[model samples]
Target chain A: DAGVTQSPTHLIKTRGQQVTLRCSPKSGHDTVSWYQQALGQGPQFIFQYYEEEERQRGNFPDRFSGHQFPNYSSELNVNALLLGDSALYLCASSLDRLAAYNEQFFGPGTRLTVL
Target chain B: AQSVTQLDSQVPVFEEAPVELRCNYSSSVSVYLFWYVQYPNQGLQLLLKYLSGSTLVESINGFEAEFNKSQTSFHLRKPSVHISDTAEYFCAVHETSGSRLTFGEGTQLTVNP
Candidate 1:
């Protein structure tokens, strides 16, 4: 089966501008979560979407938001981006949002560059 | 809250040599642990996980890790390494009551000939 997929392999945006990154979860998965991996750092959880609603969120600010469509696809939107926003955005899908035992499959990720 | 710490930022070793990457975590509640590997220009891939049961876990590859609850550590090791084994390794923790995963800064392993 195909694994999780993300769109726009790479993106470049200027400060104060907005950007949206898309993600299609792995087949047979429903929950989607977003993460940010800065240079030389591990990924930090952004938020998770389940049942078309945000189920859990990390310490990120309000400027970072996400949506989960009925088809289990997801979109991560970052508004008023700053230079520090440049990072690799990863999307992961799991069988259930609340099941701790369920493993999360990740996508190749979208590299965002804030210029 | 849960957090993970990968002790080594970079580890260099000769091919066929043994290697060890250290990881430690802190959590107030029961948590599941995981190790992920990322190659150049790639996303994170699950290496192995420690949900419960035996303290030692092995991956399809030669990699294996032992979970020490008292020490709150899960260190990854391989008896022999290859050039293709070079990659970035991350340690993560997921609290049983929470959905988010907290990851470490990552360890870059370079297996050279």
Candidate 2:
């Protein structure tokens, strides 16, 4: 069984440009969450998707948006990127919310570099 | 709101030595604690998690963590270390109501041979 997978393993963009990172959840999982990890910091939650809708969001701005397809895949879109936006975007997948535990499987992540 | 604090920024231990990485969290309600390992320039991998049941949880890779509710701490420990164990270990917490995880500063565990 494949674990969570992400596309465009690395990307380069300029200021004010937009970028979209894609993620596929683990097999048999239906929940996807996005996180940002800066150069020397731990991952920070951006948002979570469930039932094809955003269930929870972090303290991110409107420029950070996401979509969850019916197939349980998810996309993270960051608009008006700044130099600070250059970081590793991580996606994690887990079983349904009703599960007894919250064990999340993470993808290799997309490294977005804004110049 | 929930937050995690990793006291040590880096920990160095020789091979076959026992090592411990400290973690503490602040939350009002019950929480699910987790430890994730991230190699250089890689994604986070679940080391182990403490959801319920016994307070102590072990990973197949010789790492273990004990969840102390009263202390709001979930510290990772290993009896013997290997060179391959060098990585950044992160501590995170999730509220029972949702899956949002708040991560710590991360501890860089350096195993010296």
DockQ winner among the candidates? Answer: 1
lDDT of each: 0.95, 0.93
Write the residue-wise lDDT of candidate 2 on B1-113 in tens digits: 98999999999999999999999999887889999999987889989998889999999999999999878899999999999999999999988877789999899999998
* lDDT, candidate 1, A4-106, per-residue tens: 9999999999999999999999999999999999999999999999999999999999999999999999999999999999999999999984555678899
DockQ scores of all models, one per candidate: 0.87, 0.75
- What are the per-residue Cα lDDT tens digits for candidate 1 across B1-113? 88899999999999999999999999999999999999999999999999999999999999999999999999999999999999999999998878888999999999999
Model 2 has an lDDT value of: 0.93
Interface RMSD in Å per candidate, to 1 decimal?
0.9, 1.2
Give the range of the ten consecutive residues with the poorest summed lDDT in model 1 chain B.
Answer: B93-102
Q: Which candidate has the highest TM-score of all? A: 1
The clash numbers for all candidates, in the given order, read 0, 0
- Please tell me how candidate 1 rates in CAPRI terms: high
Compute each candidate's TM-score over C-alphas. 0.98, 0.97
State the lDDT of candidate 2 residue by residue for A1-109, as single tens digits. 9989999999999999999999999999999999999888989999999999999999999999999999999999999999999999999999885765567899999
| lDDT at position A39, candidate 1 | 97
The C-alpha stretches of model 1 lying farther than 4 A from their native spots are none
